[model samples]
Target: MKNKSIQIQEKHHKDLQKLSESLGQSYGKLVEKMILYFKRTGIDPDDLKNESPSHKIQQLDKRLVSFLKVQERDILKPLRQETYEYYQNYDKTLKDAKANINKNLGLLDNNSEIRANHILKELAKQRKALITLSEHLDPANKKGLKTVFQNIFKNAN
Candidate 1:
């Protein structure tokens, strides 16, 4: 490559030098990285000169929203399905427990009360799990839902 030189204002040169040091890169590498970033983002640095900060922030927000929508469709959709399946399984287990308890209620054996109490406890636990799953599925609790779903899926595997 041929050697090239360009002159910039003293203040701009100092700013670039500081950025390079902070980024642990040489000034030439920093300039190249900036050029690559601009190209990858399809952004013209010159055009930014005429754009207001609010305009830039709006653009960033739009991009983030688009990314989140895609994530919801891809990641969150499967998580939601898994959560619903878990809830359904719990409901079926609760129903089975109740049916068993009813069928065994006629026994006068000492173990009958013990078995009834155990079933009651199991029912309570299942109810609590259902409530928690419902809360995580609520539309108003997206942030909490994401965290809960992540933990659920993480532990499942």
Candidate 2:
């Protein structure tokens, strides 16, 4: 490839550098991507002749939104779905654990100490599993699940 250099104002250069870092791309790659985007959008470089800073920022924001939507569709949505399924499984496991503990409590008269120890052990295991699953969940789901587990533990005690 042929090398070319263009002089930009220091402020604009700094802004470009920041943009490159934010996008996790090298300066050259970022510029190439931007050029490709303009081409794909049928935007002529010359048409930006009188673009103000705010206008430029608005354009960048539009591109950012588009990028985020694509990311959500291509990546985040599937991951969230998987996480939701895992969360459901964990919730079912928690319910099963609670049911077993309750059944053991019902047999407390026959082997009270042994059954009590077993219930405590099962609760601890469930709590640990909940914590681990919560860590893997997205923020909103994590908060809800954590709250549920907290309530369950509080009630158990």
| Predicted structure with the largest lDDT when compared to the true one | 2
lDDT at position 27, candidate 2: 83
Q: Residue 52 of candidate 1: its Cα lDDT? A: 64
Query: Residue by residue across 15-48, what tens digits does model 2's lDDT show?
Result: 9999988999988888899989877877777785
Candidate 2: C-alpha lDDT: 0.86
Cα lDDT tens digits for candidate 1, 41-111: 77777784657668989999999999999999999999999999999999999999998988877556878
What TM-score, computed on C-alpha atoms, does each candidate reach?
0.35, 0.33
lDDT of each: 0.83, 0.86
C-alpha RMSD of each candidate structure in angstroms: 25.6, 25.1
**Candidate 2 backbone collisions, by pair:** none
